[model samples]
Target: MKLGRHSPAPKRQKCDHWSPCPPGNFAYRILSGGGKERTATICFEDEQLVGEPGSGINIAIVNYKTGEFSSTNFFHMWAHDHSKQMMDFIRSAPKGTLLLMATQDDGSTRLKDYAKELVENLGSKEIKNIKFRSSWVFIAAKGFNLPDNIQREKINHSDQTKNRYKGWPAEIQIEGCIPRNLM
Candidate 1:
């Protein structure tokens, strides 16, 4: 019989990243909703800030300097007049705040043009392209800009012919290390 020593498993980094983040950096992960059973989630600094399955949008706010989360909210846009409210919530974020957003179901059904513009201002390039039940996730900074190299936004559209689940698209996720706010 051959005897071999067992090795310990590698430690998991924040947000289950492939590797540990560099010093003075924050780790984050954002996942868009898939089918009815899979919900969207947002994680930062090793904590799950938001996770819920429903129609509309999920939002989380985090303090950039302290690496602390402040709030989580959901806005139902499919059949509600909540676009203005959501826009206000986004505008309320203060400087140095990190905004994480994900869509659970139909995020663009009732989304207005102004709201899309606001998301665009936050560096989102795919907001205008979201369709019915499209899976989308985004991370944006309020006052500063995230490095261009960092992964900040991702989207997957629901196509009947190529849907991963019945009437829904496959889930999409973005995970990476964001440098700590130095300014």
Candidate 2:
């Protein structure tokens, strides 16, 4: 007599199946000189699986005087590991290099920590040169509660401040030169 066929075992689910996985590739477009330009996706994975995405955040440095610009995006972990690269980009920035923060509330803490770490690693000397000199903008999908201390300090030191766009949740706009005067 023939034996009955056995069914195959069910495959186990991946832990990250439900988690939001990083995008397969990152895309960016640069607009300069009244024209639009597109760049290819920096490959995040390789055939050998030896390489991964460079970073999760994008840094754009625009040289207003010459109208030239350069930008690169890095994986979140790379920010710490590649401090020198980050510093070099910052140091090489030309006048009017704007530091913009665009992220959802879920990544706010990471963004804040990255900013703070950048400030700390760049050292007080470097920070002094760029903190107020650079324009800082924070775009959020949802309103974030700013701690009283942070609010007070920002208000006390920042030259200009604006909050959320009309009908928007909690977008914060901070402008003006650095408030070095704040103690």
Candidate 3:
């Protein structure tokens, strides 16, 4: 439920399986990239880091540069409820607050729709720089075929091979300012 920056998550603290902190507490972290600091939201669950950025399942993207984030859960159904909290969080942000959000791609436009919905709710008054990130796939259609040279160079089947990931979130979106522009 926290939306603003706080002390970095205690990394030295043991969180796997058993720890002193309460269960479901987000462990704040600082990720350094290109001499800039980016705060990341992390939580330990099932004896593992369940909500670290760029890793784990159903993770919420956190920016060290901008103190904005969303309530995320591993389950989509559960995340829907958490997202309501996130919606409220966004509303609570003061004017000109640099807000950011990243959503999972469930093969549907729900995430995009929700982001648009948030913007629409502002009634064209509130302006925020929202950056987004999600997974994309390049595929050949039924009638389409790649040229031999291009196929040999671009057709990386191993990179495209994955059955387990398909079941994972199809998209992961992050909107907000980081240390730099990642467009």
Candidate 4:
């Protein structure tokens, strides 16, 4: 995968102690209309899970219209494991659903794979109206990272919702990461 000029390089933050550290926080600057006036809280305490330093991955998704959010933790499991549940939820979503896919700096590749599969399956006509729009998120973590190439590959493979529909306007926030503020 080609790393677009806009792609972010690997980043990390150091902690002074080994004690349970707080999860990081993430916010997205959303562009609407002619100006960027909206900011959404992508990660909150309710969306995080605590485990051994590096035991699992936390994934979160938010409904743009209702600001409703849903999250899950994947531990020693493949993204495909959640296919059924994820598909069910997406199918029920109204048109113009913006699904955001986020992950810990380390889980980026895995999450991207999951996103790719979702787009492929949804686009194949096996499902209807359940289209994957676009995904955006910041990758932050203390250690372990996804190579820039893999990240780009996944993003490119996933279809952007905007390009797929005319003027459908629904945003679904999908986030995957360990909240820096949640320990």
Per-model TM against the reference: 0.94, 0.28, 0.28, 0.28
Candidate 2 colliding pairs, count: 6
lDDT of 2 by residue, 64-120 (tens): 222233454432422244445544555555434322232111122233445546543
Best by lDDT: 1
Query: Where does model 4 exceed 4 Å of error?
Result: 1-58, 70-80, 104-115, 120-183
Count the clashes in each prediction.
0, 6, 12, 16
Query: What lDDT is obtained when candidate 2 is compared to the true structure?
Result: 0.27
Better of 1 and 3 by lDDT: 1
Model 1 is weakest, by summed lDDT over 10 consecutive residues, at: 157-166
Q: lDDT of each prediction vs. the true structure?
A: 0.88, 0.27, 0.28, 0.30
lDDT of 4: 0.30
lDDT of 1 at 130: 91
Off by over 4 Å in 3: 1-80, 104-116, 120-164, 169-183
Candidate 1, residues 45-106: lDDT per residue as tens digits?
Answer: 99998875656889999999899998888888888768888889999889999999999978
Instruction: Answer with 3 or 4, whichever has the higher lDDT.
Output: 4
